[model samples]
Target: MRSALALGPGAEFDRIRSILGRLGERAAGVGGDCALIPAGDGQLAVSVDLSVEGTHFRTEWLSLEEIGWRAAAGALSDLAAAGAEAVGILASIGVPRGAPASAVTTLMDGVGAAAASVGGVVLGGDLAAAPTWLVDVTVIGRVEVPVTRGGARPGDGVWVSGRLGAARAALDALVRGATPDPEAREAFAKPRPRLGLGRALSRLGVTAMIDLSDGLGGDAGHLAAASACAIEIDLGLVPIGPGVVEEAARRSDPPAVYAAAGGEDYELLFTLPEAASLERVRAVATATGVPVTRIGRVGEGGGVHLRLDGREQEIHGFDHFA
Candidate 1:
């Protein structure tokens, strides 16, 4: 068995650490963040994420620009999850042999545009040939008040920024014969990270944080597990977007499922001290013009549970690499 220090939230780290222990007691090769390199501390916040053609999006439904936007935003959302302000990005694009030259150019344009959307820039990237299209992005950012998933306190209040599940609906609609509305299309095509809100919340003294790129249930569970506390979320309080509820009703799928299982909703979910100021959350919403919602509170030190009609229910968020 491996110690908690080496468990990067899964069995892979545990398995590797166990093998290393058997080899001989020695220092682990990797450090904080994502690679053999330490995630770094004090100033810079580093994060990387990947979006593949088949799993993340379909070229037929989304334009090159839209695809670029989704791929870049997915990585930026990780930085947001850590409450970091992004400065620049590096993108590596994998082109299919059948991809058109115009499509490739548009994809590049979208990467540039996505970075610009967050007041960031593209530093550099690599081009490669692949059987299918793929885009990998690494974002570099700095946060004055870094918020990590492991910082939650037992009494912290749990919150989420903006609406959930719209992206899932957009894709489902596209998969079916139904046409997506402008808002749904935008949600699927170009997801905007709440970067401003993340910075503000860090200054506001949030105990811990993560982006809701995964379903809210799963993501919040991550926060709870990391903090060694129980997470209690109120389903009724989940901020559902306009048109989403009606459309979900039309589809006969529980709106809660999308809100809980949707993978592309790039919103921020965080925990704050029970006594933290509401004013800061309000200020963030005002400055960014994005809604910040209080869906639940951290429970007695334990795991995560979704509270519906005041009853606890079992659920979790999305984990692509789990």
Candidate 2:
């Protein structure tokens, strides 16, 4: 058996699914964005996300409030991806020794603000002491009919909400000790979850849905693997966020490379039937105040393919262990 250190995030999740398969019907949502639990007359979607001090953020790179908001938004993004309406958030924090009590209060303030921004609240959680600061957020939401990642079928159109790569550019700029553009900085410090868009798509015949937390390349692969279908994305059609081209040029990398593989975007990636017209998608995008772009299509086969100027290119997404 391959050790966890040798497996990518996708493989690790697959292993988890295999283990959860022992539960049979009880594990219905184990492999998707949020675990679905039957509630009275509806299903409750729940998801948890962790932000470690070193792995997810650095103190010098972001304010305490930004850190808190980013963590909360990321956790809630899962609920959105599940096509659920936000209900509440549970936050757990680990404070290192000597950290001020005011710091905790300020962090919670940010968390509360983010939850409230989506008509949700910070319900309750536990606290602990740790060697480094950490935040773990659990989000609970309701969905009359939950969407799962495996529902995508052949002949579906792959679409994405919002442009890509600003957060990636900002990360690169921060790492290099250079100033990033205002748009890029905002994208990195405060990512907006497409809750309204997800809700709209859920009712608009969307077959499968996912949040682009792991970048387009990796997230697309996850959706493809789940649906047992192939996805071909046209690099030319992907909407690149402002400042990405310049940032890519600085590093001598193609803009498509970053747009395709950059992580922490938090945009929605979904599939709709081929019969759905672009005008319908545009209307949804307009109503949700987000831009929707069709970048690809679903086909028979497996894995995700990226085509740039009609030529195939290979790129990968962020892997924590890799």
Candidate 3:
């Protein structure tokens, strides 16, 4: 498989198409770029994301399978944020000239696996040549009531669906030429988008939501800006993932720093009105088996504020053009 993937472009592409055709047989709603089907009564939600070699991932640091899984998971996380049920995904790939056929197939296989995990399938896609490997995934979802980042209001409580920082910590370890803890590596390589949790929150009338792709602080700022509200996060309330605290200790950095500013966790961050019942929240958490934590509240102004031991702290996550 490794040797096959190292082959030249022409043969690699042919092999890729063959594999895709077989995989598409079991995946419904797959045909062309545009999928024609019956429109549901609910609203349709669509999101697109791109993952590139050297930028979003490093081939030297991760297996092709891991890279593929991360790319698809990141794209689907958007659907999870909107509280929508995924319908299908369209993948577009840019393969470097000398890249292996096996690698491309593995990448698509990862994409297919992620789609199935979210009760979706690969509808169709396009392929092209590029200087570096790239994968672009577009997700289509349906929702009775679409959640948006702009819906947060004053007095609303901020919440997160799962722990944070493991993904960032894994990246940090890789950048430093060290192997990450197994749990942290798994968190980065195979993030599970909170699709079920999003649907439950939507049903429970969540006001605003966003996936924790760009870290808690930066993503929270996005929600605040969109909703024209201020958000204050209690650092102590942030759920740091396992191994993160130890990693922080090893680096002599505060554990809260990673929870606040680490990126690519793929967890859901949302808001609910103050009047929302804690009982209902607990029920949802119990039903979904996904931990839900209240980290802060929506306030009267705009921007995200982090409070550490009652003092304000400044933190931000990843930015492509920064």
Candidate 4:
């Protein structure tokens, strides 16, 4: 049997769909960011996020509050991608041996604060003892018309919200046993999901949408594959986060690599029809306080292409099993 590492996330999703067979077809959206289920008078968007101690973060690198907040924020970003309104969250925490009760409460406080910021609250959850600290959050959201990844069409302009790579730079700093700059640290600890912008885009008739959790390269590829179209990203147009250039230089790589392929940015990647005009997109930024930049265009094909320095380049993002 092949190991999970060999299959990777994309292939593993296909394997899961194969296992579910016909039953999987019942869900409105599967193998996307979140699953949409039919509810009375509307649909619910739900997603589960897992934060493992060694895998996702280190205790020395962040406070318990930051850990909890990061987990919830990442999970809730899925709802934003679906263009849903925040509802609530159910968090399941795994406590290891000798864990302090105060630690757990502090973590819960952060979780509650995150949910409340988005007009949500903790709906209750389960607890268990484990070998390592674990936080699993299931965020629920509601939407009248949920956006799906497979809605892009040729000629749609590809865009991204906010900036990218600040979290990646912070991760590199942590790995090096150094503290990141204040801005990068804030971005890493408390990423602001583009909830308002996402809802606005959905209302404005975006063709497709996905959050930048696993970096622009991988996420954009997923969008392309889902929409059965092609995306050409101009590397020069990608918005690199502050300090990312210096971080990339330290690692002997171009800033574009980190900006395009660094995971955990939690911004939105969406497409608008050519008819949507640049003025309209900029107006959204004015309204929501989040800048949206056009970095590419969708074409009639499959897969994502990156053009840097007038040539094509290949890059890969984070993969849990890999």
Candidate 5:
């Protein structure tokens, strides 16, 4: 298996950011300080993500459209973490020599569609040869309503934009040699994040939010630890994707486990004042055509706990280091 760094979205970009000071333009750097550009008195929020063939997804399981959609959506997802309105993208693709031309076209189409879905587009890209297919995207976005992890308060209600564990379920089924049901397969192949909802949450008075690409358990931990608040999720209320229940039964894995530890769900984990009206948030989601649900709340201390039908489950999520 490839290590995280070799796979996708694993490189520690900060070290490289500081190192780039030694080099000049061209490496003029992920917009190098263009993100520093003024934004009509709003804060600039930038994020980038990469995806690789074997590590991120295997070609055997995903269709051409699925890979393309995931490539762009993954990067946009990071932007969502910051509650930013994405404007556009810069893409770089590393394709192995002798790869078919049709494959490239298909993947690029996916990128275009995904970006368009988010009200963003790819300005351009750099293509090169590598041993595997690699897609990297640098997303430029703006935050009119900053929703970082630092703002969670004790009484904040915890919520997610959509279902959990779908993508993970899709990928795990492939890994275990079990055929995924149509819904499970779709979750992994073409995961969709709640786009307008992230920014809408900001307008609706959200304090902190993150998309559930990394799994609810660890992602919640991120919001809690960063906000210095405690987080406890009610497993019973977790919104699950279609076909997850029957799929888990077929695979002999705990359905709840899939909901908690599963990666690539692309749902949002956000905090709002407990007293704030969810009517507007729901209305906006309905207007913008996405589904969202409040699942938990932040507390006084910084820690993570999971209570399921009154039984506690161990915390779970992606652990790149482990």
Candidate 6:
């Protein structure tokens, strides 16, 4: 448990490089300022995410390893939303004084592990000193047909991949100093980006796509705004994860609140053209092993609305400034 201050900068950098090298084939040909990859005729997709201590996460609630994985996954989720296959990740981290070198090693290991899970490699990064731990990851990916938020047209079907609210439930439990179900804990610590499902949807000709990092309500509003179309979400059609209902019921809180507004789900939310058949959607779901649920439709106009049992309901998800 030697402090980073004792290890100095050069030794720490070497340690990181050594850890990344152990990724084997995943880390092949990764070095220098950038990693090289063959683009062919397809387009390259890039996205960056920043995770800060105390703001985006609490070290007390999550281990250094979990924090690393969560941060890397957050960045990779953006590439998934673009219907891209991840190529590699560049992680720039700031370590605080008195931080243990072992902790930092665990963090890098987590990052490499997450990247390897999605066929991604750890290419290169920068390290610096800071007052608090900071993690920023830039993910590079490739997409033959890039899906965007502005592609949804009026009369298209709105769909979501996988269930929601488990991450929010885990956060709530941690804040209350209570332990949540294993599924909820995993959802918070290691969210699976729907990369396979996103690729399949792109091949299926999906109109628009986005990842559910900022909760369904807010993220759906983003898609609606970008497309200049109104989105009507049927709460009844939304899939609620296990334990969410019981937790909400016990607290006298409506489960729909979490289902609609909980953040960090990292699931894929997309829209398909009116001509897209349910059978086709089901086929993609079967192929990717990711469940797809149709919860609403795109309509003319702009904004996002919620419907519960045919009644219009008001709801909003996470907003960093609000």
Local error of candidate 4 at residue 87 (angstroms): 0.5
**Against the true structure, what is each candidate's TM-score?**
0.86, 0.93, 0.86, 0.93, 0.85, 0.86
Predicted structure 4: clash tally:
0
Q: How far is 174's C-alpha from truth in model 3 (Å)?
A: 0.8
Query: Model 1: per-residue lDDT, tens digit, 67-139?
Result: 8888888888877776777788999999999778887789979988988988899999998889888899998
What C-alpha lDDT does candidate 6 achieve relative to the native structure? 0.81
User: In candidate 1, residue 179 scores what lDDT?
Assistant: 87
Which lDDT tens digits does candidate 2 get at residues 193-301? 8888899899888999989888898888888887888888999899998779989999787897778888999999899999987788889999989999999999999
Query: On a 0 to 100 scale, what is the lDDT of residue 321 in model 2?
Result: 52
Count of clashes in candidate 5 = 2
Per-residue lDDT, model 5, residue 81, is 67
Off by over 4 Å in 3: 1-40
Clashing pairs in 1: 32-39, 215-318, 217-317, 218-316, 218-317, 230-302
Which pairs in model 5 have colliding backbones? 29-32, 230-301
* Model 4 lDDT at residue 305: 91
Among all windows of 10 consecutive residues in model 5, the one with the lowest summed lDDT is 1-10
Q: Mind giving the per-residue lDDT tens digits that candidate 4 earns over 9-29?
A: 355355555655655445344
lDDT of model number 2:
0.85
Looking at candidate 4, the ten consecutive residues that score lowest on lDDT are: 1-10
lDDT for each candidate structure: 0.75, 0.85, 0.81, 0.85, 0.72, 0.81
True-vs-predicted CA distance for residue 21, candidate 2, Å:
7.0
